[model samples]
Target: MGAQGCREDGRPETVLEGWFVLLLDLEAFAPRERVDAFHHAMTDSSVPNEIVHEECDAGMSARIEGWRVGALDLFDMRCSGLEVRRTARHVRQHRDRPVVSVSLQTQGIHRAEQAGTRSTLGPEDICVFHELAPRTYGWSGHGASQAVTVDMEHLGLPVDTVVRASGRLRASPVHDLLLGHLRSLFRDPGRLEADPGAGALANATTDLVRALLTSAAHDERDGRVREAMGSSLVPRIMAYARRHLTDPDLGPERIAAEHAVSKRQLYVVLGRAGIRLEQWLIGERLEAACRLLVSPHHAALPVSAVAARCGFSSPSHFTRRFRAAYGTTPSEWRRHRIRSIC
Candidate 1:
C-alpha cells in the first residue's frame, strides 16, 4: 500500500508509492472458472501465452500488478509454479507484434530461454527476451518477476543486437544502473500514473533501458547505433502524447508542434509503430480512464470527472468508448470491482 496520498501543493505528502493498475488476481475467479479466467486475464490483460500449470485442481494463485511507462509495459507478477511459452504458432495465430522484455527475478527460481540461448536469472539479475521468437518462463516453485516490455522496432537497436543479447545475464555496471531504476520505479509506478512529472519519469525509465541495451549490444564499428537512435521517432512522440493525454488540445497537430514536426511527420512516425495516431490516443485515454475507475485515489471522483481527467471532452462520448473497449459502462465496471477496490 505504498501508493497514495499527496499534499495539496500537489507534492507527495508521504513516502507512499504511486498508484497502479491491478491487472488480475486468481482469487477473484471462482474455482470452477479459474482456468479460462486466468488464461483470458493473462492473454487479454497483458501478453498472450500458452500456460502449463503444475496442477489444474490445485489452488494456483497469481496477481498481476502493472503500469505503462509511455510505450513500455511494466509488469510485476507473482504466481505459483508454472511453465509459460510464446512460440511461432502463438505469434502467428495472434498476429503478435515483435515485442521484447527486459526482466528480473524478484523471488524463487526462474529459467528462461530464447533463440538457442538460455539463462537462469536470479534476484537482481537481468535478462532479455522477445515475442515472434520462441521464449519460455518457467519455475519449479512459486516465484515472481518484474519486466519492462517494448517493441523490437521501438527499441532503437538493430534486431540482431537484441537477438544476440537474448537470454543472456547482464553483469556490467550498466545492468546495475538499469535494475536500480527498474526496482525504484516498480516500487512506485503509481507516481508515474498520477504525478505531473509522470511523463518525465516514464521517459527516464525508457532512456535507462535504451542506454543499457545500446551499450551492452552496440558495435561501434558499424555506426548503426547512431543511425538507429536518430531515426527512432516513435518514443519522442509517445513521450509528448503521454504527458499531455489530459489536455483537451492534445492531438496530432499540437503534438507535432511540441516535437517541432509536421502533422504528416507525426502520422509517419506513429505509422512506423503500426498504430494510427487517433486510434492510439483513444486507446490510451480509455486505458487511463479504466485505471482511474478502479484506483482508490481516484475512486471518489465521479465517472464523468474521470473521463475529463483522462481528456475526453464529453462524458457521454467517454462512456460509449469505455463500454466498447471494456464491454461495460464506466459505472458498471467500477461497481463490479467495489469489493476489490475497498
Candidate 2:
C-alpha cells in the first residue's frame, strides 16, 4: 500500500482503497532541513503552503497523519511556531482544484488570514480556509491541529456563503458534534481502517460538516462577528477609513457622506460591530502612527511628522493616546522594536 500524504507525482490518487494512516515526520532533521522538508511535503500533497519561521534559529517539528476518505482528506497535525502562506503562485501551480481546509485548533492560538481578512482561532475553535485562495496562517510558539480537506465543488456547497463565513466558527452544539466526528475518524485511523463501514463513515462525516456550515451561515445572516468584520461591505468601510485616516476631518459625518449613508445608519452598523465610529477612527490613526514610528520605511519620519500624518492635531495628545493604548511612548516602542530586530 502507498503512503497517505505522499503523492507519486504531486497529486493524491486513490491507491489505498480503505482508510489508512500516512505519517510524515520531521523530528530527526535540523531546523532548516525540517522547514524545507515540510514545504515539499505540503506541495506534493497539493496543499500549496509557504512557511516562514518568526525565529529562523528555532528548531521545528511536525507530524502529520492523514486519512484518505473518498475525495476528502482528514488529517491530524502538530507543528512548531511558523507562519504559513498559500500564495497565488502556488495556487496557479496547483491548478487542478481548490481545496477546502477546515481545521480545529487543538493547542494554541491559530491566526489565519485570507486575502486581507484575518481571524484568530483559539483552542477548540474550528476555522476553515480555502487552499487555492491566497492565505497566511500562523500559530503562537507551538501548536497542534486536526483538519479535513475536501474539494469545494465535491460537496456542492454554496461558494459565496461559505466564503464569507470562513475562519469564524465558534463553539456550538453542531460544531461540537462535527469536532467529535472528526476526532473519532482521524485520531484512530487503524480502527476505522478495519471497519467495513469506512465509506459510510466518510459520507456521514461530510454530511455533518455540511450541517455545521449551514448553522454557521444561518447565525452569520443575523450579523455575527464574521459578518461585521469580514462581510462584503466591511472591506469598503475599512478601505475608506484607512485612506482618510490622516485627515483630521475624518469622522462619522465624513464616512457617512463618502459611503452615501446617513450618519445614523452608519452608527447603527458600526455599533452592531461593538465599535463607535469616533473611537474606531481615533484607534486607527493611533495604530497607523505607531506602524510608521516602528517601520523602516518611515524610520526617518520624525514623531511629530508621524502624528501629523496620522491625523493628530497635537503631538502631546497623540503621545498621551499612544501611551494609554500601548503603555509606552512612540519613541520608546520604536527604539525597543529596532533593538530587538537588530
Candidate 3:
C-alpha cells in the first residue's frame, strides 16, 4: 500500500477484515515540515482542493484518522485554526466522482458555507456539504469534528435535492436518528467494521441518507407553499376565530395550534396587517353582543345572556366594555334601540 492506503507519517495503515484506515498525525514531523505534509495528506485522501493557513508556528498541529467501509468513508479531524475551500475549479475536477458529507461539530465552532447558505454550528450540531458544489468550511481556535462522506450515487438522490437538503436537515424526521447513528458509528468504528454485518450496515446508512434528503425536499416544498399562502393566512385565522367566537377557551394559543403555526407567528402575520389580535377579538365580541341585544328574535334574552352568547365570561366585564364602546350601559342601549324602532 503506497501513500493511498498507508499513512503519510510512515505508520502502517490499520486494515480490518472489511475496512481501509488512513491515519496522519503531523506531530511527528518537524514544525517546518508539518504544513506541507498536511496539505499533501488532505489532497491525497479524498479530493483535490486548497488548504490555507493564516499563520503557522510551533502551535500548529493537525491529525486525521479515517476508516473506509464499502462506499462510506468516516473521518475524524482535529486541527488548529485553518480554512479549506473547494472552489468551482475543484468541483469541475471532481465532477465525475460526486460525494455528500455530513459533519457533526464536536468541539469549538465550525463555520460552513455552500449553495448561498452559511451556518455556524456548535457542538452536536450537524451540517451537510457535497463535493459536487463549491463550499468553504473552517474554524477559528481549536476545532474538531467527525464526518461521514458517501457517494451521491449510493444515496440515490438528485444533486439539486442534496444541495437544498444541506441547509434544511432538521426538517427531516430522521435527522436526530441519523445523528445518533453517526455518533455511535464514530464512537467505535473499529468494532463496527469488524462485524459480519458491516456491509448491511453500510446499506442501511445509505438508505437513511436517501430518506433524509427526500423528506427534507418535501418539507421545503411544503414550506414554500405556506409562505406563498401568507396573504390568505390572516384572513383564514380571522374567519376561524369568528366561527369559534362562543368558545370560552379561544385565544392566541388555541388559534395558532388550529392553524399549525406558533403564537408568535400568528401575531407577526396579524401585526403586519395592522391587526391586534386581542383588540380585534374584543371588538368582534362586542359587535356580536350589540346585534343580539337589538334583535327581536333575542328580545326575551337578558343582557347577561347576550354577553354569555358573545363569549364574555363576566357580565360586569361586558357591561364595562359596552359602556365604553357605546357611551351607555347594555340595558340603556337596548331600550334606546327599542324606542327608535317603535
Candidate 4:
C-alpha cells in the first residue's frame, strides 16, 4: 500500500511505522485568546502569517500544537489558511542558519516554492523548504491540512543524501517514508509520550529523518542509518549506568555482569564511541552531583551530603572532579545557578 493510504490506527502497515508520537494538548491553552496568542507566537518565531476568516469554516475549528520529538524537532501542524511569505525580510530574520522545513499535506492543497522549484501538494503530498532561503506557501480549500516540519538542528544526519534518496517530488520513496511517519505520528498522538517504546521509536525517527535530509542535501549515501542502529546500544548502557550511578560497585565489572558481557567487551563497546568506562562513570557521577547541588530540596544539605548521594565517596575527590568539569566548586556553582534563577 502507498504511504498516504496507511492509517494511524494501524489498519494498513508501512515500513516507517515507529517514527513519531503526536502530542495534542488542547487544555494547555484553554482560553480562545490564549490559543490565538500561541498561534501568533509560532508565526513570529518561524514564519509570517496572514490568517483570513471564511464563512465556509471558522478560521481554525480546533487549535493544535504538534510536536515531533526525536533527536531533532518534527512539527505536525493542522490549521486553516496558513499562508507564509518568505521574502528577503524572512532570510534576514534568520540570518545565515541552514534550516529545512518539510511539510506533508494530509488534507488541504498547498502551493510551495523554494529555490525556483514549485510544487503543489494535495492530500498525502509533501513539500520541503529551506528556512534560510526564500520560499512562499499558500493553502486553500475547505478542509485543513496536516504537515510535519523538521528543523535543521535536530537533523544531525546529513541532508544532501536524504534528498537524493527520497527524490525531489511526489513520486519519491524518501518522501513516502516521511509522509508515512507523519501520518503515524498524527494518528497516535498519545503513544509518543506514554509508550514504553517511545525512546527507541524517537531514536529511529531521528535516524530516518537524518538519513532523508542528508540524502536530500548531498547526492551521496552514507552509512549513517546503519551506524545509528548499531550505536543504539549506547542508550541502554547509559540508562544502566544512570540507574546504578550511586552504587560503589557500579563499575565496568558490574556493568558487564548485568549485561551478560565481559568487562573487556563492555570497554570495547564504549571505546568505539570514544568514551572510556571510568571517564563515563565519572561524568555520570558529576552530572548527578550537579543535579543534587542545584535542587532546592537539597540546598541546605552539605557538600558531603550531595557528593555521597551522587556516589562520590570522598568529598575532596568529588570537589576536585566537580571543579575540573564545571570550572567551579559544586557549592559555588549551585549557589550561582540558584541565585541567577531567583
lDDT of 4 by residue, 274-334 (tens): 7788997899688778768887888899999888888887899899999999899988998
Candidate 2, position 196, lDDT: 74
Off by over 4 Å in 4: 1-39, 44-62, 68-76, 95-99, 157-172, 216-342
Q: For candidate 2, give the lDDT.
A: 0.68
Instruction: Summing lDDT over every window of 10 consecutive residues in candidate 3, give the lowest-scoring window.
Output: 11-20
lDDT by residue (1-342, candidate 3, tens digit) is 323233666433444333445466676667776677777777667788888775745478777778766567889998988889999998888856678998889988888888888898886577888788888999988789899888887766677878888888788755765677677678668666677857766766666666666667665356543342343466456656776787767899999998689999999989987889988898979988987999999999999899889998889989999988889999999999999999
- For model 1, the stretches where C-alpha displacement exceeds 4 angstroms are 1-18, 56-58, 94-97, 169-172, 219-342
Q: Which runs in model 2 stand beyond 4 Å of their true positions?
A: 1-23, 30-32, 56-58, 171-173, 218-342
Clashing pairs in 3: none
Order of candidate numbers by TM-score, starting with the best: 3, 1, 2, 4
Q: State the lDDT of candidate 2 residue by residue for 1-342, as single tens digits.
A: 554343555333223433555456675445556666677766666566677865634567777776766556777778888788878887776656666777778888889887578888876567777655677888868788888876777655666556555644553335655565565556567566556766755655555566556556566355442333233233345445666678888888888886577899888877775667777788878867867887889899999899999999889988999899989998998899899989
The 0-to-1 C-alpha lDDT of every candidate, in the order given, reads 0.70, 0.68, 0.77, 0.59
By lDDT, the better pick of 1 and 2 is 1
Q: Considering summed lDDT, which 10 consecutive residues are worst modelled in model 1?
A: 9-18
RMSD of 3: 21.8
Global fold similarity of model 1 (TM-score)? 0.57
lDDT of 1 by residue, 1-342 (tens): 543233354322223234566666666556665566567667665466789987634578777777776666788888888889988777665544566778888998798877767767788787777566667877866789898887666565666667665534363324665666567667666566666766655665565566556656655343654543334346545655666789977988888886578988778777866769888899989978877888888879999899899999999999999888889999998998886656
In model 2, pairs of residues that clash are none
The deviation in Å at residue 101 for candidate 4 is 2.9
